[model samples]
Target: MTALTQNRHSPCIGICKLDESTGFCLGCGRSGDEIGAWASLDEAGKDAIWQLIPERLQALSVRVRLLPYAGGELLDWVGETIREGRGTWVAGAPGAVAEFPCHDRDATVTRGEDELTAAMPKARFRLKGSEKLRAFAFDGDGPVVLGLPKRRVALPMAEVVTPLGPDEAAIDPEFRDHELFDIGVARRASRFCVRTGDAELIAALRAAEGRHWTELMAKTGATIIEKSPHRVVETGLARIEVFAEIPPPGGTSPTGPHTHLLAEFLTTGEEIPAALGLPEYAAPIAIFYPGTPPA
Candidate 1:
């Protein structure tokens, strides 16, 4: 029973040629190439270039964009604590597991700034067969930087969006705390569901949402998003877009303010393991990568 480790084949397609005008790569799906070509292109061309690109795509890859804290908090779930009842996903467990410490089925281990800063270089060590990194940044596939056990895990989650400021957005509590992390662990265990379609899946998400809300209401004895209408929109003939402004598993107020890692799932009456590049709801340990919260 081993824990999850790095993929030897990083989603790195070594295409580094930048398209100066588009800031994107004809080689890779990046956006830094076109800045140099800007003067030569029409304003319309520049407008059409990056309608949907995230401001940070130029600095992201499948490895880093999706999972940035590969070294720092990446191994937060992988450790002897799997047996210590500490975090959630215990390292060597086989076949659909949850984070190591259940912690009452509704609590989270805090990886607050102090913890992260202290665990610094040690957390940066790479796992067996994985390459090490120097100075982990949000741009590249951050440091593998740790001796990790290889195992597939999943998480369960529900997102609650909040306003950070006039422009910036971030997850509440500033980051994914323990409860949120468990969703990932739950995903792999058939213990979680993150579906977007199908009456049953929708019902499940609603149930998860309800459970979360009810727990919060019970704890804080306050009402939040309880009045917001949770519904679906017809995005396509057979596909409907479902959305809700629920809160994070931890509580009502977010840490700073920003969007969370919410996504749309398409169900064809079959088990979908993914939502676009995002992992399906049943992911054991969500690989969350919080960025510089909007200021």
Candidate 2:
């Protein structure tokens, strides 16, 4: 039988240490009980456990290892790492495409004295110095090294101005009178897009977007609707509802579309925002602007 037809088995990667807090095996994300019962578990039970592993692994903290390479050695090590299938490569910049299961042919690394740059499709890294290079590993999927400047500064989130135009306003002359409509409007005008108080989820969304937004959505099994000016992305973890081509509150024209993220919980198929007991419009924890550098 081919690899695709082969039966599934254990996920152990040999680094079988258990996390104290979560009681899960660090390498395979299986609970101690799960591991002990794995051999006797039925196929359906195994499948159920496998379905939960991704979210469990995502919940764990990422582990980073600082390699000992310096100067020109950094460049050589990067090439060798990719060739050896160490991990996927992620460009340091926001909105940069990540190279998952990166192959040597799909990556190019070049160096000049103390600086280096690695280029992959739709992703590029420009490093001012190689002294501070490090590798990031997430859920054992990486030792992925990134080229970044020695000193980096955090940029503030840019303001998104979406004035309600006449056409949009005409949709509902009494929209302001409706609380739900006002909530949606306020969300669009707010600096942040994601509406959640969960710090962990916020951090995960930020890190995931920083590495690769599309990849994160795909990994989470998100359902995406790519219709212009009105796109929606819904996943088990979060939901993003976007409204684009908005104009000024009283204006008549439409402008380019912008995006925002909305977070809510679901059970079966029903939304349960009240489960968190958060206001209809909680303070945004994270905002995402596709094709634009994260703010």
On TM-score, the candidate that comes out on top is: 2
Scored against the true structure, residue 190 in model 1 reaches a CA lDDT of 28
Candidate 2: where are CA atoms >4 Å away?
A: 1-65, 83-86, 92-101, 119-125, 136-151, 154-295
Candidate 2 lDDT tens digits, 28-59 = 77899999999988767876786677667677
Candidate 2 lDDT score relative to the true structure: 0.36
Residue 182 C-alpha lDDT in model 2: 13
Models, CA RMSD each: 17.9, 19.3
What are the lDDT figures for the candidates, one per model?
0.26, 0.36
lDDT of model 1 at position 206: 39
Candidate 2 residue pairs that clash:
164-248, 164-249
TM per prediction: 0.22, 0.28
Instruction: Give per-residue CA lDDT, model 1, range 123-180, as digits (tens).
Output: 1111211222111123453221121221332222222211111111112222112111
